[model samples]
Target: MSRSRGSFGQIIFADQSRIYNTSTIVGRIRVCGDHFTKNCYTKTILGIKKRKGGNVSSSFVRSTTKSGRRKGIRSSHADAAPCGQDAPEKDVGCKSRIVETSMPYADHDYSQRPPSLEEQLQEAQKTIACQEELLKLRKNRFFLERFQCDDRLIMFYTGFKDYITLMAVFMALQPTAESMLGWGQSLADQHIIRKGFEEQSPPLIDQFFLFLCHLRQGFLVQDLATRFNVSQATVSRICITWTNFLYCMLGSILVWPSREKVNELLPLSFKNTFPRTRVILDCTELHVKRATSKVLNSETYPYYKGTITFKSLVGISPYGELTFVSDLYMGSISDKEITQTSGILSLLEEGDEVMADKDFFIGDLLSPINVRLVTPAFSKSNRKLTPEEKLQTQEIARLRIHVERAIRRIKEYHIFDRTLPMTTLGSINQVWTVCALLTTFQGPLF
Candidate 1:
C-alpha cells in the first residue's frame, strides 16, 4: 500500500492503485475502506479495541500547531484486508497509515454568572432569620429540666443530692418564696409596693435554681443572666432576694439538738471514749478582698492566712450534724475569742464536755460553766511527749479530725473557693450562713 497526504489534513491509503481516506478530530479517529466515503466507521483512537481477523499495535502522533507546541493524537495499525477486499457491512476492514496533525486546545472551564445584589441581600436575610430562631429557642427553655434527672449534676450545680432533695428544700421555702417581691423593687420597697415587673422575672422555681447555681458553681452575674435569659440586674436581685429569704427561713429552724437528743444519737466511737461530749468545734476562714480603708484592711487581715478574710466558728454535734454556725467575724480574731463570743458556751449544760483543737484555749472560759474540754496533748516547754502521752495524742487526733471534715464539706461549695468581692459584701454574711444551713439537707456528714 502507498501512503500519501490529502487536503484538509486527511491521510490516503492506496491498495492496488485504489485510494481510501481517513479523517481525524482532536481526540477521535474515523476509518473509511472500499465502502462509500459517505458511510464512515468511527473508532476511538486512545483505546482502540481489536476486531476479529486482525492483530493491532497502538501508538500516538505528535504534530506542531499554530501556537508551535506539539499535540498528541493517538493512532493504531492493524494487519487486515486491503481496500479492495469484499467484507460484510458490519465488519468492513481496512489497512491505513499513520497521520499527524494538530488542532487548537479546547477550553474546559466556563465560569457561571455572579449573583445580583438583590439576590445576595436575600441570602443574607435568610441567614439572619435562622440565627434569631436559634436564640429564641435558647431563651424560652427552663434551666432546671436539664438537670432534673441527674443526681450528680444536681449536687454539682446546686449541692442538693437529686431533684427530689432540691425540690424538698424548695417546697419548704416555696410558700413564702413564691410570693416574694418583684426583681425591679428594692429590698426596702417590697412591703410598700404591691408589684413592679414581677411578670418580667423567670419562673419561681427557675429563679431558685439560678440562685443555687450561682452559689455552687461560682457563676458570674452576667453568666447567670445569659443562662436564665434575664438581665444582669434581675440576676443580682434574685440572688439577693433568695439569700435573705433562705437566711430567714432556714435560720428559723432549730439546728441544735438538745442534750438528751445528742445523747440518743451520739456515735459509738464518742460513746466509748467520752459519753458526755456534746459538740465538736472548729474555726474556718474565707478570704475577702482588700479594703480601701487602712483600718478596715487591718481589721480583715489575718496573720496566719496573710490575706484579708472573714472567720467563723462551726460546731457539729457528736452525731456529725451541724449544731451551730456562728456569724462571720474579722479573721484577725483568735480561735479562743471566736469560741467565747460565738455564744456556743451558753448552749452547754452542766457537766457537758466540748471537743476542739489545740488552738482553742477556751478551757478556762468553759471551766466556770462546769464544762470539760477534749483536745490533743501538746509539748510542755521544750519537753518531748512520752510514749503514753504519744498514744493519747493519737487517740485525740483521730477524734478531733471529724470537725475538720465537717468544715471541708462546707468549703466544697466553690463560691467560697475564691476571695469574696466588695460588691457581695451586702449579702456575704447571709450567703455564708445559708450555705452552712443547706449542708443539713445533704443527709448526714457521717
Candidate 2:
C-alpha cells in the first residue's frame, strides 16, 4: 500500500502506478475479496521525488505502500471514522489552477451600465447652478452696477446728461485717416506751394475726447473697446491724441481767478470764512511707467513711488472752479519750480492771497510776487504760532479744504490714481484736462 497527503485530501493505493494515473476519489471504497485493491492520486504524491535524481529506496517505497493500503482500508469504513472523512482532499490542490484560469485579466472588458437621461439632466442642472452662483459672487464683489433712476430724475440732472451728450457727440465725430488724408490732399491740390510738404493725417481728436469721457465715467480701455465697438489700439490712439491736446491747448484755462470773477462767482460766506483768498494752489503727483534707462527714469522718478510721474499744479478759485492747471512736469521737479516755470506766478497780481499746503514755501515764491501765501505757519525757533496766527492758519486750512475736494474729484478718474502705462502719459494728461473742463461745465463747486 502507498499513502500520500496533498492540499485536497489523503490518498491510499495498493500500487503506485494505479494511483498515479487516477486524479480524484471522494467518499470511501471498500474491497472484500483477497484480490481487492484501492488506488488514489493526490498533488503531494506527484510532488514527491528523490533528490540528486536517484530512485527512492525499495524499503521506503514498500513502507509507503503499506501506509497507503491502511488509509484505503480505513477510508472504506469512513462512516466508523471521523466526521467529514469522506470529503476528497484533491479539490483543494486544484484551487490555484482553477482561479488562474477563471479570474478576469487586467485588459478584460468590463460590463458598463449607461447613465439614465434623468441622471444626465440632474448633473447638467448642478453644473448650471454652480456656474450661476460663481457669476453672482463675482458680480457682487467686482462688477460696478449700472445706474438706476426714473426719467424725471434723469431730466433734472441736466448737467450730468449734458456731459454724457457731449461725450457721445465727441465719440461720433471721430475722423478716419482717409478723411484726414483727403483734407490734406485737397489742401495740396488747391494751395500748390511747398515741394516736400506732403499731406499729413490729422490725429483722431474725436476718439481721444471720447476716451477722456470713458475715463471720467470710470471705464478701463478694454471695457471701453467692448462698449464702443473699437479695438484697444484705436482707443489707445484716441486717448493719446486727446490727452496731449487738452494739456497743451487748455493749460491756460486753469488760471487764478481775477478779483471781479471771484467776487461774482465765490460764495458770500467765503469772504467771512476765508479773507483775502485769491486761489488755492496745490501740487498732485501722477504715477507713470518707468523709463527704459535708469538715467532717463531718474529724471521722471517720483521719490514716493520710486517710478516716473507727472506733477500737476492745480489752482482752484474760492468758488470751486478750476482756475489754472499746469502742463505736466517731470515728477522730480519741485512744486516751486513748476510754479515758476509754468508761469502760474505770472497769473498772480499784487495784493493777491494764495493758499496751499506746507509744501509750498510762500515766503520765497509768493513774497517775491507781492502775493501772500497762507498755510499752517510752522513753528520757528521751536516756538508755536501766536493765538492770532493759529486762528488765521485754522481759517486758511478750512478754506483750503475746498481745493482738496476739487483734487479729490479730479482723481476720481482712475487713470491718475496709480501708475499709468508709460506709453499713455500724454493721453492721460489730455484726459485729465478734458475732465477738468467737463468739471467746470458741471457748475461751480459752491
Highest lDDT: give the candidate number.
1
Shift of residue 223 alpha carbon in model 2, Å: 2.8
For model 2, state the Cα shift of residue 117 in Å: 47
Which candidate number would show the highest TM-score if scored against the true structure?
1
Residue-by-residue lDDT tens digits, candidate 2, 1-446 = 33334322433333312232222232332121112112221235569521322222221211235546533222222222222224555222211111112223455345667779999999999999999998876545311121113323222322234435544544544433224322223555746734433322123433443455466555677876665556776565555545554554445454556688887776776777665677888988777777788886888886765767878888898888888876678889987788889777888888887889987865687787798877777787889799988887787787788887787777766556666777675356666666666566555667
Q: Could you tell me the C-alpha RMSD of candidate 2 in Å?
A: 22.5
Cα lDDT tens digits, model 1, 221-259, are 999988877889889889888888888899999998999
TM-score of 2: 0.53
